[model samples]
Target: MSARVAVLGLGAMGLPMATALARIFDVVAFDIAAERVALAVEAGATGVGTVVEACLGTDVVVVGVRDGAQLDALVLGDGGVADSLPTGAVVVVTSTVGEAAVRAVAEALAARGIRCVDAPVSGGPVRAGTGDLLIMVGADDEALAAARPVLDALSSSLTVVGGIGAGQQLKTVNQLLCGIHTAAASEALALAHRLGLDLDACIEVLSQGAAASFMFADRGPRIAAQLRGETPPLRSRLDVIGKDMGIVGDLARQLKVATPVAAAAEQLYRTVAAAGLDASDDSVVATMLAKEPAW
Candidate 1:
């Protein structure tokens, strides 16, 4: 029999992973939002009412919550699923929380002999639904062995970074680059618009040259369209990146890493959030960028 799996949290990223895992396992999904649960059920997985209900007797639990505080509450706080998991069951935390936070959660689960992996992921929701995610994992060999099926089901590119907390550590660096690239891409496109250039042609040329970046290819067109007042597909949310970049900042401060580019990018995300685009897609950063320069 396939490993019985439960996917806790069915938001944008979580829902897609849940649906993809459902194709190969006995997957049950849970979330606070009724609409989200409804969507998961429609996608072929059973939806459960509570986290406890979702994890009861499961072999593995895949967590895809929003941030550290929420992940803490879900795994260690009241009604937390960690307390409910059977010994030997693995918990895979795919949230991009800090290494420190993931270590704390892993240590707690180890006390119960319930293995945990700090596995942060990249690629957006579409890649998640297709099991094409880029997954970075941190776990011992045994725990990794136990979690392999679930990991394989959700990733096209997978690497075991190190033990216990290394995955989140790498993820912090990953977000550092992501934030810088996103901020820079938005600024460049916004500048092009200010110059009255052919937006589509500009994007095409930039993508073909050394100036191109993954963020430019992935978010550039959406940013262009969003500037024209079109609502693009929700691949990533600003509030999510706002939260991720905040983790990156905290890590940088703790380790005394100078991050001028990332700090500047973080500030742009802050300004965008203040303008009420947090719930919108990250491409909405272009809206804030396309305004008159203060200088």
Candidate 2:
């Protein structure tokens, strides 16, 4: 029998994932923005108005919201998942809302006998569209078993980290590394420009050498474009990284760990966000770094 999936939040990541899920499941996608719902229809999902409508007859609910607060509002507020989704339905929280947030959501769902899975994803919208995402899932064995097929359809790599909220904790660490690598890439390329090296050659050579990383290979060309005054299409936005880095900051501070380099990278993203480039692709940090004063 084909599973019925309700996908909430039709943003960059959610739309693609919902579209992909529609291939294997009966999918009804919902978003507050009517325009986004229309887009989901074009992408193969059945679009709906209310979150409650999306939940009707669905066995699994996928949450791909922007942040913790958004997730909370959707699952806990008026007309929310807690009040709407039927008992025994599994709720997969794919938003990278850190540990505490996912934990609270999990606890709430458990109260109503709804299974919750903290399956925070990596890779951007493009990957989500093709089921090439890396999902770190945090759920007890029973919930994981119940949600496995749904997770299988969405991710190439699905690792069960531990009990509820562990996925977000791991994703937080990923953001720390990713933020630092992105910032480090920008810092390097900007320095190459300042040193009068042929930037084309610099990017080419650096990307081939031991200095190359996944972030460098992936974000290098875009960073190169930013250096030349061009804006690349976003795979992930500046404010997304800024927001993610902020999550990292919160987690690190709570753990009392010293993260000097990560802190510096977070500040760079914060600066870019404050300068009104929040909607710009995160590679714009290269431009910010290339400026005389940088950040």
Candidate 3:
């Protein structure tokens, strides 16, 4: 029989990942939002109301919460799934919470004979539904093998970085570049707009040349659209990127590394938040930079 998978936190990434997992496994999904749960059911997963209900009888529990606090609350805190999950069941953590947080949760779960797979994912929500994400894994051999099918189903490029906490570490590195590149893209596009360059053409040229980066390619059009006063759909949220950049900052501080450029980008995200765009798409940062200086 195929392994039964329980997916917790059916938000942007969770909903789509559960949809993909339902195609190959018996997937049970849970989210606080009733609408999201309904959407999960529409995608062929059995939607439950609580974490405990989702965990019971599952061979693997996949968590896609937003942060360490939510991860703790969902897995080990009040009304969490730690006790509900059977011994030897694997918990696949797909969030980008920092390495220390994952390590703490892993240790707690291991005490109950539950295996934890630190497998933080990238590639946004669209690729998640199509099972084409890039997954960075940090788990021992047995735990990795146990979660392999689910990981394979969700990832086009799955890399095992190290054992427990390493995936978060690698993802921190990823977010550092992502945060900086996004800030750079915003500034560049904002400058283009101020200089009377056609943003569409400029993005095309930059994306094909030495200035090309995944972030430039991915967020450039959205930045251009924002400069044109059009609201792009929220593909990546400012708050989420802000959270990731915060994680990068924390890691850099802990390791005593000087990342001046990333620090500047992090500050720009904060400025975007202060401008009352915290809840907006991250592309909105471009608008902030594109404005004429009052001085």
TM-score of every model versus the real structure = 0.96, 0.94, 0.96
What is the RMSD of candidate 1? Answer: 1.5
The lDDT per prediction is 0.89, 0.89, 0.94
Residue runs of model 2 more than 4 Å from their true location after superposition: 195-201, 293-295
* Model 3 lDDT, residue 204, Cα: 94
The full ranking of all candidates by TM-score, starting with the best, is: 3, 1, 2
Tens digit per residue, CA lDDT, model 2, 45-91: 89899988988878899998888899999999999999998899999
Between the candidate structures 1 and 2, which one is better when assessed by TM-score? 1
Query: Which structure among the candidates has the greatest TM-score?
Result: 3
lDDT of 1 by residue, 1-295 (tens): 3789999988888999999998889999999998999999998888999988888999999999998888899999877877889999999999898888889999888998899988999987889999999999999999999999899999999999899889998888999998889888888988898888887999999999999988888899898998777999887899888888898899899989998889888888988899888889999998777878688
Q: What are the runs in model 1 whose C-alpha is more than 4 Å off?
A: 293-295
* Most lDDT-accurate candidate: 3
Model 1 has how many clashing residue pairs? 0
Tell me each candidate's RMSD, in Å, in order.
Answer: 1.5, 1.9, 1.3
Off by over 4 Å in 3: none
